[model samples]
Target chain A: MKSEKQLVELSLKDDKHFAELVERYEAKLSRYIFHLSSLDSASTEDILQEVFIKVYENLNGYDTSFSFSSWIYRITHNEVISFFRKKKARPQAISPDDVDEDYITLIPDDTDIPKELKRKELAAKVKKAVLELPEKYRDVLVLRYLEDKSYQEISDILKISINNASVLVNRAKEKLKSKLTI
Target chain B: MSKLADKILKKVKKANIKHKPRWQFIAKRIFIWSALIVAIILLSMSVSMIIHQMTVAKPVFSEHFQKREFSPIFKLVPYFWTLISLLLLTFAYFDFKQTKTGHRHRPTIIVASGILVGIIIAAVMVSVRAPHNMEEQLQRHPLYQKMHFDKDFSKGPGALRPLMKSQANNPLAFPKN
Candidate 1:
């Protein structure tokens, strides 16, 4: 395994290598945040920059003992959630009535979902349902189900305990089930 | 896979952005020009000092005899040390600013340079005053006079400093060191 310091030194030498980290995580994270937020490309792009800048700033604090991917993804998740918080305030012009309820769900995407997208629309529904849940529960749910992270990964990312993550996910799921049904 | 991942990849790719040519240009421009100005001034001062010292020395030290006159501030070590340190720092700052590798360390460099400036000022002040104070102590204190700068010199200066002291009362309330 390469040491974190070695990777950092390489990243310092080449911005392209640092670009590789962006290529690695940006889309899925963007999807995760987009489901949470109704943010457009420019806004998502702005928050995404904040996430990477935070990662660059705190890379030295990365406990080499942990996975670098998880650490950075955790930061991305936090950034999006905070984006929701700030944007949620000041009363959005988007009212709850403006949301359409005409979402379609065919056969759980078992046939067409690429293996990489193992959960497919199931994950998308979970993300949508998660966004509908109470704020606290929604963040945990999206990080857990949409990302398909292990409970420990969820805990590490959320800065919560394993048990809290588990509990939050369950509460989020129950709320999601109720929300998705309607 | 690339298409499925494209949207997410877009986010990450944006993060690894080639921060626009304009911002890079600005960072490099500001850093390089400031560093060049500082280097030029420091270089001119050092060169002039060396030329002045060599030109002004009395003949006993100026002729083929060739003895160097040491300024109290410049003496006791190599003259290029401070200049070399500044040059290295300027190189580091511009290098970081140009490459995007050193933004996090900008704070460290700023704080370290501030401390270095403080230390250099204190060193210059102490270097100027120490010899003058020692000369006065040498003539005034017989106990220190008998101990004139030898194996016992270290202890003698500390002993003499106490006798020359006047008032411990700092009534004018200066800033704490």
Candidate 2:
């Protein structure tokens, strides 16, 4: 498989190659769109098309220094923000998912099967708490935990400083812990 | 291939918007930064002017400074300029957050620090401008001569009685210069 940079270079030359880039990111980006906003599958799909169009428009100016994923996520972040503003609506809560394997250990680290079951319940609670967080804190929490992004990547995507990203994550964890204990 | 990808690919083929030059984005960021700098400088200047006015009204080293008990100059502070400076700084603050990478630091801390730095610079500017005695300037003006207002008048009407009684008792209320 070609590296992201290679795809970017190839996509610039041949329009067909851009489809590959879109296909590569489509599922992840769609999931991200759903996680980040209140958009349903239909609306999410519509916005995904818009995001890809924008990504294509700016491909030539894309700086190679940053990770392509961060850049694409940044664009998606902006698109969702604009979408909310246009609709004059607050983001709705995300549904529960089984993507909490990484956080399962944090639950208790007991027997594998029962701990897994407990972890899933805790994960659902955490996700619900995350949805209740203020937009800023929620964003960092989602990017940090759900997306498994580093502070630097979160910073790049959200256009915040690494220090701020760290602060937000710490604060978000505290909020989530408080929520779970209740 | 996802439906979104297929639709987006069709739109890309049909729209074909070219990439904007890198320099344009760079130029926009540069402009935002420059504007923020200019706003800070203006804020500092306004603060300096306020400090200058206060310093002129009361020279700290002068033994003769009677520290007017009720001078109208106290009410004449440049509050308007202070408000303008604050508003300009706020504008700069929002503009800064919009700039690339501006959101990394906490907004309150950066703005507060920027204001503190502006004030420090303004204080330095006031020191460099040197002290001018506003009271002395007012005394030397042609209007003061024409009006024949008593020098003690600036100190309030109640103050005149004490000075009159002292002058009558000592013959020289203030010693010969």
Candidate 3:
């Protein structure tokens, strides 16, 4: 990887700079995206790339005082929310008739004969549970726990006050804790 | 300074839209240029219209206008309107051509369709109603004299018509004779 100064120098003009920004952010952003939803790493990468694309296009309108990262993150968060909403609108996945024993084996350890049960379902589980939270609270949790953004950073990203962000995050944690415990 | 910021920033740097196809750049240029051109045209026409109004009306100094036969261009509203309609359609056509893609943008398409439909509806309504209006206006032509004198000039006191009285039993009053 190039030095930050070198990369910034190369990219400040526009698109190429944006590409550089992507190259710099993809891995971590992908992880963040993954946490935002239970998407596979590849899907996460794709979404992360998309978020950057939006950022690049909207950069001209972006105020210099606001952190670019925050702006991009908000866009990314919005995109993920929209994605889930779209997914919800679609007909849900039906369980296959011939449940492969091998497929079940691939998923992490679980108990006895479970034809009615799901496999892995970690991503699905977290998605549904997290999504059940109110939009603001849900966003705070997704950014804080899943994306691990600081309150200040999340506030900047979300265009919200830091205190509000903190309150939301704590509320989100409680919500998640309750859902996960059950 | 922290690893998280460092990490997020790193991703941010890599995520810009340079990787997007070349056509997108062309699209941006086209939008910018076309919007600018339309904006310039609109501005120029507006200014020209304003100037024409000022010259024709001499609004600011009534004395300057009194000597001139500066009847307002407002009387030619219909003609001006037709011209504006034509210009709008032409602009819409160009915009449609410019914004056209293999797959049309639904919002833009709907908006264009709406404008076209609205214009057509208005034109039809005007065409349908215009003859009646023309006839009515022509009928009222000699009204300058017809309405100027009272029906019975012999009656000095400006008596309103009998229809102006309420149709109650006595109306207002009745003499025995």
Candidate 4:
């Protein structure tokens, strides 16, 4: 398996290599787009296509100093923002049902509901709370928790300082906990 | 291959979309960096001009203050140059923000550093008397001369001192000597 940078170099030379690159990131980016936007599957696919096309077009612009994943994520982040801007609409919250159960554990909650039924209820509430956060906080929380990105990676993707990334995550968590309590 | 990837590939092939040539990206990066450097240089020059104006006008300003002449003191302040410096600083800030990692810095840090760097460069320019040379060059321009010479010291006590001194030596006034 070629490293991502090698793949990028190869992709520049041949469309076939670009296919491999696309395959590698397709599912991950699709999921990311789905999580970040309130778009339907068709719109998600449309946005994904635009993202890949942009990625392909700007291949030469990618800097070697940053990881390819972060760079790609950053592009996807921008594309999604552009999508929102073009529509002149605020990003609606993600549906709670679409959130994975594993992500529910990531939300910082001190409450220990004993029953599975109550736990599921709390999970739905937490998911809704996470999704409904102000865009800045929600974006950081989703990238940090759902995407499992490090603060440094989140910083690069969001074009924020590492210190700011961590600060946003902490604030997001605090906001989530307060929402849950309320 | 994933269906989405295949579809994208087919679309890319159909549309004949190609990676933008490497030089274009390089040119873009160079343009942004060049813009940032130019903004900094301009900012430095503006700051140096302000410093030059202040130093040159300080004595005149003090004299006017002592004489309770408010008009020349106000004219001596480098308001125009200060405004130009501020505008250049803003341009420098935005240019720095366009750099790859510029967003990683806080606005306060970027602005503070820009100001600090501008001051340091301006200080160096002042040390080499660059601002004085620039002022001399500017003085030759008719418009600069008109605006600067007329508003600055043309009617002030300093400009009148020669006339005042020359009159005191007139033979008609001191015929005994």
Top lDDT model:
4
Answer with 1 or 2, whichever has the higher DockQ.
2
| Pairs of residues clashing in candidate 4 | none
lDDT of 2 by residue, B120-158 (tens): 988776666521233224336555334322224345533
- The top-ranked prediction according to TM-score is 4
Which CAPRI category fits model 1? incorrect
Off by over 4 Å in 1: A1-6, A88-128, B1-177
Query: Cα RMSD for candidate 2?
Result: 8.4
Per-prediction interface RMSD in Å: 11.0, 2.4, 12.0, 1.2
| lDDT (tens digit, per residue) of candidate 2 on A98-159 | 33444432222222233344555655555556667788887887788768899999998998
Indicate the residue-level lDDT of A57 in model 3.
Answer: 55
Q: After superposition, how far is residue B33 of candidate 3 from its true place, in Å?
A: 26
DockQ score of the complex predicted as candidate 4: 0.59
lDDT tens per residue, model 1, A1-182: 44545665566555445556666667867776565565666887878777876665554455555567668877887887677677774212232333222222212223333345334444555445545567778667656655677877766666655666777777766665566555
Q: What tens-digit string does per-residue lDDT give for candidate 4 at A29-106?
A: 988886676567887888899999999999999999899999999999898889988988765655555555655665
Question: What's model 3's lDDT at B74?
Answer: 30
Chain A TM value for model 2: 0.82
Residues B66-160 of candidate 4 have per-residue lDDT tens digits of: 99999767766777678989999999888887898887888889999999999999999988888867866765665555454233244553442
List each candidate's DockQ score: 0.01, 0.38, 0.03, 0.59
What are the TM-scores, per candidate, against the unseen true structure?
Answer: 0.41, 0.69, 0.39, 0.83
Candidate that scores best on DockQ: 4
TM-score-wise, the better of 2 and 4 is 4
